[model samples]
Target chain A: MNLALRDIRHHLGRFLLTAVGLGLLLGVVLSMIGIYRGLVADALGLVRAPAAEVWVVETGTRGPFAEGSRIPGDTRESIARLAGVTETGSMTFQSLEATHRDRKLRLQVVGYEPGRLGGPPAIAEGRGLARSRFEIVADVKTGLVVGERIPLGGDVFTVVGTTRGAVSSGGDPVVWMALRDSQVLQFRLSPAPARREAARGPVAAGAPDTINAVVARVAPGASVEAVVEAAKRWKHLAAMTQDDQETILTRSVVEKARQQIGLFTTVLLTVSTVIIALIIYTMTMDKIREIATLKLIGAPDGRIVGLIVQQALALGLIGFSVGASLIASAKDFFPRRVVMLPEDAASLGLVVIVVCLVASGLGVRLALRVDPATALGG
Target chain B: MTGDNPRPLVECRGLAKHYGEGETRVDALRTVDLDLWPGEVVGLLGPSGSGKTTLLNLIGCIVEPSAGTLRLDGETVWEGKWLRPDLRRLRLEKVGFIFQFHNLLPFLDVSENVALVLDMAGAATTDAFARAHELLDYLEVGHRKAAKPSSLSGGEAQRVAIARALANRPRIILADEPTAALDGERAGIVMDLLRKVAVEQSATVVVVTHDEKILGRFDRLFHLRDGRIEDMASRPGDLTG
Candidate 1:
């Protein structure tokens, strides 16, 4: 008879309840890992969606997402004229909160020219922006469908298409609009500011044609490095290859959040180890007399140690399974994206096993110290 | 029947056990010489702090004797120091112990409690369980074989404990106050079972007890006082002061 299994079976209710409590704790640990991955994924989503080989922004800026980077809208033409640059699209980025159906919708607005390199990654519903001024392609996370009209800066734009999983680094859904409309909404002064400007003197007829950055695609078998170098010569702009932009976003944009989550994960695992040790210690204390009797009956110390270790392992594995299940079932309900990968779960399982082995040391120590003579005493 | 085989089954010479040192020193068992033959039931009587349990512990190989030459079944297990490399296996294969509390693992059923001993001795699961059932049947607890220790009456639990002690068919059976909590009738039945075990299995049985009710049931008795054997009786109730 396996004593550990028999003991657990005898106390099945309490054991299962303990496992569930541990499982909930483990679930939080797993969620932290998922959230970290989601943060990286969300941070890189808008950068990757353009599918461009190079990005041209204001001098000294990492990219449009990391900080403010504005170049003239005509920077696209300069990038397009460069050798190996197959296509270029000037795009602007800004976050806006608009009220639709009396519900406030937070969105990351991307302004790109029609039939350009910058557009929604894929159209899950409706169609892409076909008009030059008012049509919009919005991500489904914004809760907007095709044909919904929302006002932006004194003008209303109609949503002509919908996309999915296109969110900004901050987790707001994205909306694509015509470059001219975005320029008017973003750069055009409000009525008060415009009137104030008018009072000073006759102002320019329109807002300056400024865009956050220009995205350019290099031709097949072309050297993207060559185009980047050429854009750098402009003195007014800085350029980066696609790989560099992704590195900047992951390493610099979300680095602090990742570190914070990692620290929390470490602390939670430490807490789990302590909890497991205390639990195993208490369980062993409960059976100290039985252990003495076992020793008196000629049971080797190995058998007693095996009993404690087996129970600890069982507790950890059961708790891990419960936590993984809970997180997988509830991930979609979280406000932020939670991306759980198979390897992550497997790695955490291995860590839990090691933690259990280490945690059972306390119980093993107490058991080994019990004197068999105690069994013969009153 | 006690000395029919001529050779002693257990021998102890100059055996001693002590605790602490110097000013704090306490001798639990003093130098002693003894012999026990096969198929004999011996009883050890002592008051509290008489070192009866300490002697049992040394004989059972669960405690190391301070100084001694001790042999069980003609094998010298302790000579000044332990001669046996694996005392646990020696205890498992050669000696069985019954405690006052029955000490059946509460999580295990009566049969499993018995089978655990055979399992520790490296017996196959099916055979160990089969032997457990057989021993439980012999002890008249076969109907309660599936019952947990907590569910059984005191008498039934002691019977299960006896079955467990006999599981490996050990040559030496040591009982420490096995009937301390039993009524006179129940205690007599337990003594009768131990006597039967010695005669039928040809095992040397040593029982440590403070109860006088079962004194006349032993084939020989040793009265211990102040860490020494104060008296020895060759027959039931026979002693030399």
Candidate 2:
């Protein structure tokens, strides 16, 4: 009779209805996992944008995101001079606002040398920083069009090229300009500081040579850790390999929030486990008479157990399929991007298989306890 | 095949079953003796609470007797509330049962319901279905082989049940009120079908019933009263159509 399939066929509406309900709960759990992935992707995008093999910052601090790191702008020259260093650039990051009519745009301004490693990694349209000081290459997220003019800090720059997914770890669209111009913009003193510098007269009319951090790429086959150690020897500086920076960004920067969301996902999955167990147990209970009859007819114990386990797994698989579809379709509706990987789905399937087997335990116990004589009745 | 040493298909001596412990213990069956030979169909008659079903259950190996012995097809299967260790194997290989309800698995078609017995007995799929089809054809329900139990008429469903009981080609068929829910005509059809399967398949058949109308079909009738067989009558297929 293929008992499991038969039972499902006999009660398909009820089975599908329960699966949908379970699927929604599972969908919420899968969504939580997707949000975690998005958080990592967004956080790492900026760190990965430079593709720098090593970073040099102020000594004893984690990195730019976790702490302030200011080194002399001229340090890029020294870093590039190192034996195995292939390329070098000094960069600055700061949040700035520009008013275009009544709509204000918030962006993270990035200053990088032209024709160097620190510029926008890829261009989606137009070109990269065609003119230097007055031209800007912007992320598509900025809602600006090619050749458009936007005024920022008393100077209007032309948008020459566009990039996709070029945002800061904090999700602000990135705006690229020449390193020198960024230095001038970022190092601008507040009125009080400018007044204090003015008191010292023309001696300080020119800004100091300073930058947030220096980024470097190591030669192919050269160890980045060795380069970092060489840079860190400069007593006034600290250096981190790319992997260290990734850790600091995801672990130090986003770990706490990720863990929080991860906790909710775990809770939801636990609830799913219990709910599946209950549904299977209830289904088994409803068919107690049939089970007893089968037992009385001398069906083997393994056969009975197989029926319960198979039904439980069928329920789990259908629920997961529905939940995965729901998460995939609804991802765009979420505020943050939701990344669902195929590997993650495969991994979740393994876990659900185990959960289903464990869930069937309750039903198997109750079924085995049934007296076959019950089929004869009182 | 009829010789002095021809083995009995089923034999029970002083078979007893009791329920409860201490002061509340009661005997559901007590010290009953009986014998069933191959190709014999027996009917057990009794009123409510007379332990007719209890004796049938013991004979079918679904329950253990509290006292005495049971041998099936020349093998001693029970002694004093203890059943043989291989009881499940014996039951699967040698026993068939029909209940008051048709009890065909509702999700399966008539053929699958019949084939399930051989499947459980570890028969190959093609062989199981082939035998199932043969049985349904013999029972005159071949046209309904693909119909699920829920859609089948009463007579058709019971006949399918009869087909299932005969699926494993068991040595004995124990039917408890097989016609309980059927009209007279349908009951007569089921009884006739069961007798035909019993004799043609060469299995001893035991029926426990309160219905007097179908009494004429049995080769021998045992009347159970207060856990004892009160009478044994031999008259074969008097109601056979």
Question: What is the TM-score of chain A, computed separately for every candidate?
Answer: 0.95, 0.87
lDDT for each candidate structure: 0.89, 0.84
Encode model 2's per-residue lDDT on A1-378: one tens digit a residue: 578988898899999999899889888988888888887887788778889999898888887877877787778999998879999988887778888656888888888888887888899999997565778899887889898999887778899999987777666788989887776666553356754563564322245566778899988998888899899889989999888989999888898978899898889888888999999999999888788878877788888998899999999999999999999999987857688988888887777888889988999999999888877673
User: How is the predicted docking of candidate 2 categorized under the CAPRI scheme?
Assistant: acceptable
TM-score of 2: 0.89
- Give TM per candidate: 0.95, 0.89
- The alpha-carbon deviation from the true structure for residue B190 of candidate 1, after best TM-score superposition, in angstroms, is 2.6
TM-score of chain A of 1: 0.95
Residue A311 CA displacement from its true place in model 2, Å: 1.9
> Model 1 over residues A22-102: C-alpha lDDT tens digits?
999999999999999898888898999999999999999997889988788789999999999899999999888888889
Candidate 1 lDDT over B130-181, as tens digits, reads 9999988888889998899999998888888888888998889999888887
Candidate closest to the true structure, highest DockQ:
1
DockQ (0 to 1) for model 2: 0.49
Candidate 1: list runs displaced more than 4 Å: A188-205, B1-4, B239-241
